[model samples]
Target: MTRRRVLETAAFGAAALAGSRPAGAAQAPNVVFIMADDLGYADVAAYGRPDLATPHIDRIAARGIRFTQAYANSAVCSATRTALITGRYQYRLPVGLEEPVTTRFAGGLPAEHPTLPGLLRQAGYRTALVGKWHLGSVQDYGPLQRGYDAFWGFRGGTIDYFSHRGTDGKPDLWDGDLRIEEVGYATHLLGERAVRTIAASVKAGRPFFLSLHFNAPHWPWETPDDEAESRRIAGSNLRHFDGGTQATYRRIVAEMDTQIGRVLDALEANGVAEDTIVVFTSDNGGERFSDTWPFTGRKTELLEGGLRIPAIVAWPRRLKAGAISAQPMITMDWLPTLLSAAGAAPDPAYPSDGIDLLPILTGQAPERPRTFFWRYRANDQAAMRDGDLKYLKIRGETFLFDVVADPLERANLKARRPDDYARLRAAWDTWNATMLPERPDSFSETYTGGQLADHFGAGGAPTPPRPALAGEAPR
Candidate 1:
C-alpha cells in the first residue's frame, strides 16, 4: 500500500489534488483542527449568536469555507472523535460503540486500526493533541499509544474547569502520561499548549497536525475567573447542575474564543498561517443554555439539532476565503480531506467510509448525491439523509423531513412523501446492516428522574441525580 498507489486509487487521484493546490502546494500543509466539546450550531457568532461574542471562532469562517450542512459522525463526543480519526462510521469499532467512552469503558481504539494522526505521522508529520482525550482513560488506551506523538490534556468526557478534575474527583490534567497540575483554567491551558506546539513545529521544520479538543462550554461550566466556584464544589461531584448561567456561558465561550485567537495568531507568528489547514468546529451540538436557534434537539439525541454543527476550514493557500458550501460534510470526511491535502492517503489495503471532500471544498467539484446513516442506543434511534430527504426514527416513532427546507425538523413528511420515506428508511436499514452490531451496553440504562445519562459503557460509579432540565435536550 504505497502512497503513490493510494493517490492513484483516490477518487480525486493525484493529479486532481495537485491541481487543487496553489503554486508550490507540493509541500504538505500543517493542520490545526480545533474541536469544541458540545458547542452548538448557533453558539458561535458566525452561526448567529447575537447575545454571545466569538470573534476568533468566527475568524476561520471569515477566512475560508464555512460548511452550512456539516455534521459530526455521531451526536456524542467519543463516538464522533472515533469517526473523525478513523474515517469510518464509529459503530464499526467497539470504542465507537460507546456513546461517550469514560473511565468505565474498558475497550479502546485499538492501535492496529489506522488513524488520521497515525497516517499523517507516518508521512513525516508531527502530531499532538492538546485537549480532551475522551476516547479512553486507561494507560492501555491513551492517545499517544494510538497515533499522536504527544498528548497534554484530560482523558475523560467532562472535567472541572477550574480544578481540572474529572467526575471521579482526581486530577485529570496531564502532560503526556504523567499527571501535571497546572494552576489555570483548562481551556486556557489547552490553547497555550497548542500555540506553543505550533511554534515548535515551525522550528522543527516538519508539518504538524494539532487536534485542540477544548472541553469548554460543557458541564460544570466555569470561565477563567471562576476560582471560587471550584472550591464550592470541592466536596460534591464535579458535575454541578446549579453552576452554569447564560452570563457564565458567555464568559466561558469568550474565554475559548480568546484562546483560539491566540493559537491562530501563533500560526501567523510562525509564518505558517497561510500554509496551515485550520479547521474549527464542535464535537456535537450545544446543551443547557446553548442557542440552537432555528433547530430543536441537542446532544445525545439523534435529531437535526444534535447532529448539525458549525464547521470552517481555513487554508488560505488552497481554499478561497469567505466561501460557503451547503454540501453535507461529516466528521469522518476530515480524515480523507486532510490526508489528500497533505499528499498522503489511507493505506490501500484498508479503505474509508467517509468521502473525500477536498474537491468540493475547493470549488473544483459540485455537490454530489450522497446518503448518510446513523444508529444509536440499540437502534432506539436511526437516521438517514439522502439528497434532500431525511428519514428518522427515535423514541419508537419514525419521521420524514426535508432537512434542507425544514432545519427545525418540526414537519414530519412521512405521509406526504411515503415513497421517499420508504426509500430513506430502507437505505438506513441496509446501511446499518454493514456496520458492527450495537453493544448491549447502549441498551442497558438506569433512569435518573426526568433525565437519562450514561446510555452505554460500564458506568458503575455513582452519578449525581440527573434532573431533566425540562427544556434541555435528552441527556
Candidate 2:
C-alpha cells in the first residue's frame, strides 16, 4: 500500500480501537468554541508571536493538543463562518458566496440549513452565541433562526468596539434579537455574557454549546480606552483606514486574551472544566498589523497566511496536556469533530465534507493526510493544499510550492515538479466543479485610489465602483 493509504488504515484502526465515543467521554461534553476575528497564525504567543503576551490563550495550548496545520475555510469572516456552522464548504450555499456578508449586500445564512448549534440543541444541548453574528440581520437570517437557542450579539461584520455601532454606525447590539443598549467594551461584554451563559447551563443541569466569537484586533483598532477613537470614527469609514498603531493593536489582543482567561476561569469555577471541550481559533488571517510570520499574504488573499490559523483543542477528560499535532484540518472540521465528541452526528441529509477529528486528537489514531481547496473572489485567487504541495492561482498567475518545507511559499516548483503541479491543479478543478460557481454580481471588497496603491503598490489598476454601506460618510 502507498504511504497515504498506510496512514489512513492506521487512523481507521485507531478509531476502531477507541470505539464509537472518545475515551473518558461518559456523557455529552459542554463545548465552548472561541473564535477570534482577523487573528494571524502567529498572533498568539504559543503560535510564535514573541512580542505579544497571551497567557490565557497559551493556557489552553498548555493543557491540550495544538494543531500546527489548521486552516480557515475562507480568508474572510462570513464565508469561513458559513463553513464552520454547516460543516461543509462555504461555496455550497448561496450565503457563503458573499466572500463576506458585508453591508449593502443582503446575503445571510439560510434559516432552513442545518447548523452546528442547531444539531447539538436537537441532541439535547443548550446552545448560545454570545458575540458577532455576521450571518445575517435579525429581521430575517438571525442566529435564533439558525439553531442557536439563545443569541446575544451584533448581526453585522464590523462593529465599533466601544459604541457597539455597526459598519453603518448604527446601534447593533442585541439581546436575543431585541436591540438593546449596554455599556462596556464589546470583547468584555461578550466574554462576561459567555460566563453567565455557562453558569446558567450548569445550574440548569444541561450540556451547553457556547460560540464566543470575539471581534477584537479587527478594525477601528480601538482598545478599551479608545472610546474617544470610536467617537472620532463614528459615521465615517468604520474601516478606519488611517488609524491604529502596533502598540494599540497589542493592547487590543492583550485585552482579548484577558477575557479568554475569564472564560477559562468560569469553566473551572463551574466545576465543569473537565467535562467541557474548549476550542480556540481565528475566523481567518490578520490584516495590517498581524504577525503572520514565515508566510506570505494577508486577509482576502489565497496565501498561506490568509488561510492558516491557530487552532487549539482542550478537553481535560480526553486530550493530554501539552500535546501537539501537525494535523491538516479546517474550520468546517469543528462541526463534525465537536459533534462526535458530544456523541452526536451531523444531519444525514446534509453530509459534512469534514471528518470527525476526536479519534485522532485523543491519540487513538495517527494523523492522516488530507487535501483542502480554497478560492476567493478578490484578486481571482484559487488555491489547493494536497499533501505538502500547494497550488496557487492569483491574478491569472499560477505557482506551486511545497508548503511543508517552505511555509513562506517562496519557491516555485511548478517547472521542477510539473507532474505534481498538474495533478493538484486538476484536483482543484474537479473539486471546484462540484461546488456552486461564482455569480456575475458577487461582491468582493477591493481597494481604491491610495489604498489600492498601498495594497498593490504604485501604478496599480483602478477597481470597479464599490457599493456604499448604508449611512457611511462619503470619502
Candidate 3:
C-alpha cells in the first residue's frame, strides 16, 4: 500500500521520586493502575466537566497531581494497551499497528514480550488484572501467560455491561482461561474483584500491581440499572445501536465512579492506602455520548480530544496532596514510571520509548518540552505536537496550529508557519521510519482485504453499515 492509502485508517501514572518512600511508608509500594475505556478528557469532574461528577477519579487528582496534557500512545484501545503493557511506543510492535484487536485476528501480544506486569512479577511483586484484557484471549497470549499471576475479566474490546458477553456470543469472562459465570453489572463485579484482590494481597503480605481497566461508558452504554437496554441489544450488534442519551452517559460515568470509589475504599480499609501508588487514567479518549470540551475530535481522530485524557497519580506516601503538573505524559510513560517506582527495569532487549516521570512528579526535576507524534490509518491522519505548535494532516490536507493557543484547533497556521510545519512533518516522517511496519498478520483473516481497504477509505469516509464507531471509537 502506498503512503497515501495508509492515511485513512486508524488509529496512566503516577508516584514519585526514585525509592524515596515517605517516612512511614513501605519501601516496596503496591501499584494500582485504573484505566477507564473510551472516557473523555473533560468527562471527569476534576478535568473541567460541569455536567458530571467523578469524585473517586477526582480524589486521585485532588490528593495528588492532575496531569494537564496526558495522552495515550494510540487513540484506539488495543494499541494503547500495547504501549501501556510494553512501556514502548505502540508503533514499535506489530500488535500496536492494529487499530483495535478484532476477535478474528490471529496474532496477539506474544507471551514472551516484556510487559509491565511481567517485569513487576519478576521483581517479586504479585500482579493481577481485574477488567478488560483486550490484548488477546488465545490460550498462550492471555494475561495468565503474559505475567499476570491472576486474571479475571473479559478479553475483548467491549461487552454487554449486563450480560457480560462479547459480540462473538461467547462467555468472555474468564478466570485463568476458564469461562466463569457471574451476576450483576460488569463494572460493579470488576470493582468488587479488585477490592478483594487488594485485600488478599495485603493479607498475603506481597506488594501488588492491579490493573483495573473498566469497560464503562464504552458502548452498549448502559448504567447499572439499564437491564432493558441490555435486552435491547441482545440480538442486535453488541455495539448497542438503539440506545444511549446524555442522561444515560451521566449515569454510566457515575456508576464507574462509584465502583472506583469502592475499590479505593478497599485500599484505605486494608491499610495499604498510603503504601500504595494509585493511578487513574483512560486507555484513550472518549467517544459518542461523551463531552470532550475545550478540545476537538473524538476517539477515531488524532485530535486533542481523542489523544488527550484525564490522568492522576496518588502515591500518598511519595507525592504531596493537590498538586498539578503540566507534563506531556503518555501511556507508555507509565511502564517506566511504575517500573522505576518498583525499582525494576524492563528487559534490556526491549527498551522503553517512554521516560520515567518520578523526577518530575516528586518536584526533583523541571518539566521540559518534547515533541509527540501520532498517526492513524484512517483519513491519513498524522500529527506532531512540539512545545506550543502542532502540525496535522487529515485526508492529505496538512495544517498547522499553535495548539497551546488554539486548544479547539480552529486556526490553520500552515501558511504563516510553513517552515515549522515542514520541519515538524519531516520530524514525524523520520520518527515513523524507525517503527515497525503495519503487518498483514495483525488484521483478521475474517475481513476481506477490499473491505479493510474500504474501511481505510482512500476516497473518503467508508460506506454505510458503518457502525457508529470506526476506529471503533468504542462505536
Candidate 4:
C-alpha cells in the first residue's frame, strides 16, 4: 500500500480506538513558542555542546519531542520569521531575502495574508507577540495590524539589550502602541512579560498563544551581573579582560537559558504545565561566538550550518515524553501544527505551504511524504530535499548529498547520483517557474562592500580590530 493509504488507515484505527474522543481530540492547549535569535545547531547542551551548559533547553528535549532534521525556511532572521508566521514559503512573497531591513523599503507582510495569531484568535484563543517583530515597520505591518491582540517588543533586527535602542537611535522598545523605556536586559524583560501575560490569561481562564522571540546571543552581546558571576565560578577566564567581549557573549547565552527556565517555572506555578504546549527553536543558524559545529556556513549563506536549527516541542499531556523524531520539518510547519493543536481549522483564503504535524507527533504517521523546497532570492540560492537526498545550489555551483548520512554535508554525491540530482533539479525548475519575481524593493545595496563601513561612520577606515581569542591569557 502507498504511504498515504497507510497513514489514512492508521488515522482511522486511532480514531476507532479513541471511541468517544477522536484521535486528535483535546482542549486547545496553550502554546508558548520561544525562539532564540542566531542560535546554532550545536549551541545547546541537548545537541552536544560541551562548552555551553543549557540545562533548561536540554530539559525541553528530555521532556518532549526533539526534531533531529528540522530547518528554518531561510538562513536569515526576517525571511524565516515571515515563513513561520504566514505558514507559506517566504519566497512566495515579495519581501523574502537572506537579509532584510525596514529602511530599505516600505514593504510589510501583506494585509491579505492569514497569520497564525489571526487563526488562533478566530478559534477563541487570545494571541500575543512579546519580542522582535521584524516583518515590517509601516503602521499596517506592525503586530497590531497583523493578527496579534497585544504586542510588546521591538520592530528592528538587532538592538542594545540594556538600552533597548537600535543602532539608528530610535527607541526599539514598545508596549502596545507607545514606546516604553525598560530597565533590565532584553532577554529577561521579554521572559518576564511572557510570564505576566500567561498569568493574566490563567486568571481569565482563557487559552493563549504566545510568540516569545528573544534576541539573545545575537550581537552586541551583554550579560547580567549574576550570569557573569556564575561563569566566573565555573573557572571561565574573564580577568584582565581586554574589553572582555567574548566573556560577555558566553555569559549572555547562559543568562538567556536562565530566563527560559523562568518561563517554564511560571507555567508550573500557574498549574498549567501539563496542558500547555511549549516549543523552543531559533530563527536561523548561529553566528559570531555562537557555534553550529558539524554544520557548515553561517547566517547569510545557503549551507547546512546556516539553514539547520534546533527545534524541541513539549506537550506533556498529549505527546510522548523524550521522543526524538528525524522527520525533516521546517519553520512553515509550526503554524499548521499549532493551529491543529488548538482545534483551529485552516483558512481557505490563506492556503498554507505547511502541513499538519499531528499525525507525525502522535505516531499515527511515520514520515512526511512531501519534499521540502527553499529559495533565498537575495543570494540567488536554491535547495530541495527529497527523502534522504538533498540537491543544493549556491553561487552557481551545484552538488547533492544524502542528508541522512551526512547531516554535516561533508561529502558530495552529485557525480554518482546524477539521476537523483536531475529529478530534484527538474522539480525545482518547475517550482521556480511558478514563483513570482522577487519584488524590486527586496534587494538592498547596503552590505555590498565598503559601503557598510561608510554608513556606520568609520570614515573610510579599514575594518575594526578583531577581539583576542576567547581563552587567550595575558603575557
What are the lDDT figures for the candidates, one per model?
A: 0.79, 0.85, 0.80, 0.75
lDDT of 4 by residue, 108-156 (tens): 7888888888777666566789998888772657887777777899887
Candidates' TM-scores? 0.88, 0.91, 0.88, 0.83
Model 1, clash count?
0
Candidate 2 versus truth, CA RMSD in Å, comes to 8.6
* 10 residues in a row with least lDDT, candidate 4: 458-467
Residue 50 displacement in candidate 1 (angstroms):
0.8
Which candidate achieves the best lDDT against the true structure?
2
What's the true lDDT of residue 185 in model 3?
94
Residue pair clashes in candidate 2: none
Q: Mark the 10 consecutive residues where model 2 has the least summed lDDT.
A: 457-466
CA-RMSD of model 4: 10.9
How much lDDT does candidate 4 score?
0.75
**What is candidate 3's lDDT per residue for 226-284, written digit by digit as tens?**
89878877855476545778999999889999988998899899998998999999988
Better of 1 and 2 by lDDT: 2
TM-score order of candidates, top first = 2, 3, 1, 4
Scored by Cα lDDT, where does model 2 land? 0.85
Assess candidate 1 and give its lDDT.
0.79
Off by over 4 Å in 4: 1-26, 225-246, 444-475
